[model samples]
Target: MSQSDAARWEARYQAGTAAYAAQPSAFVLDWLPRLPRGRALDVACGLGATAIALAEAGFDVTAVDIAPTALARARTEAERRGVTVDWQCADLSDLRLPPAQYDLIVNIHYVNRDLTAQFAEALRPGGHVLFEQHLRWPTPVDGPGSDHFRLRPGELRHLLWQLDILHYAEGPFDGRDGERLALARAVGLKHH
Candidate 1:
């Protein structure tokens, strides 16, 4: 991603017109009951919507993002919601997270292929991972240039095949911009 890209996202968050939806991602909500009660990490956590949701659900959440402005918004939201979360203002791609430190890792609407293995390795025993992102498709659907950031067919599942996949889905969805949602929703026990 370019500096401009990061700046653009920061600007969108600073605009603060509810850039983040009040609700958590559908995949996270769907898999909430099955999630182990422990520390969770929200990668590329823009504005802390998912992080706040996880905290509300009794998970010790660490939300990481590159933009301090965005983190500020997230902090404010957490304060307003009366829940606490560790908001780390760092680029996930470069940050070093402790191994096997989280029981759950959630990456929604963000795809960082290079970080997939690292994320999976960070899960503790019987940990779960909830992933949801746009898919690359030939026909335009969600918005212009979505294909650029979206995943290709079977990309997420294939990348996460090492984990015990509990759910997988890929298709066009009406919600969240005309984009296709691909989820590699998984529950796997780390081999000790």
Candidate 2:
């Protein structure tokens, strides 16, 4: 994405017309048992749903997003939900992150293939990475947005093959016009 695209997302958040929900994603709730009781990072955390959820689930969470408006909304929701999360406004593409610090790293509904290796490096020994995103589907009509942001078939699982894969799947799922969801979840342990 170009500079203009990032600015557009900021402008959209600033508009405040899009209703940001205060609840967490269902996938996160479903796999709550898999998360470790330690520090976690929520990447591209729009509105802080996943971040807040992690905190409530007893993990120290750092929520990072590019849009200040979105971060503001997330902060408000975290307070309303009576949980604490460290909110950071920074572009992950350029931000320097600590490696091997977190016990869990989460990415939901966001796609940045270039960061796959970086994410793996950021995990501590026995850390798990949970990822979910929309993917390109074989449909007659084209969906919204650029093809660059959408995942191809089996791309997510393939990207993390070097890690210990716990679960993986790609297919159309319910909610929001039957989105094509791809999940590549795994645990990676550092050498002791």
Candidate 3:
């Protein structure tokens, strides 16, 4: 991530309660029952909602993010929720994910196409990945202003092609704030 981008996110998180909603992504919650309870990674884990949910679900969870302010808020949320989560403040762009170390990886509302291969390699055999991100659309919507962060149509399917796709969908949906958004969601399982 660029220094400017990091600054932008830090400002966004610090400006208001927009980033730390104390609620897990709806996509993660939907697939919670199907996911295995084991070592898990929550990439770009803003406010640790998904990490807390995973920890509550009995997974050993590690949450990573670039913003210290975000991680600090996440830590408070984790403490309040009475769940233990290993929190790391590091730029995902500079970090190397451990290979075959996680049973599941959850990434929501963040986009870094370069991390797709790392995500696959970081998961244990038969491990799962649950990902959701805003998609580029003809109409404007509330999300990252840059096209660089938005996925093109069918792009996510191609990104995770190496994994066994359990579920995949791309279309308009209600966002966290109830606004219509073009989003892509998928669940993939690495082959054992």
Cα lDDT tens digits, model 1, 70-89, are: 88878998999999999997
Q: Show model 3 residue runs off by greater than 4 Å.
A: none
The lowest-lDDT stretch of 10 consecutive residues in candidate 3 is: 14-23
Return whichever of 1 and 3 wins on TM-score.
3
Taken over the whole model, the C-alpha lDDT of each candidate is 0.76, 0.74, 0.88
**Each model's RMSD to truth, in Å?**
2.5, 2.7, 1.3
> For residues 102-128, could you state the per-residue lDDT of candidate 2 as single tens digits?
888888767777676677677887787
lDDT of 3: 0.88
TM-score of each: 0.87, 0.86, 0.95
Q: What is the lDDT of residue 15 in candidate 1?
A: 78
Q: Which runs of model 1 end up more than 4 angstroms from their true locations? A: 17-22, 143-146, 176-192
> How accurate locally is residue 93 in candidate 1, as Cα lDDT from 0 to 100?
59
- Alpha-carbon shift of residue 150 in model 2 (angstroms): 0.7
Best candidate (score: TM-score): 3
Residue 111 Cα positional deviation in candidate 1, in Å, after optimal superposition: 1.4
Kindly give the number of clashing pairs for every candidate.
2, 0, 0
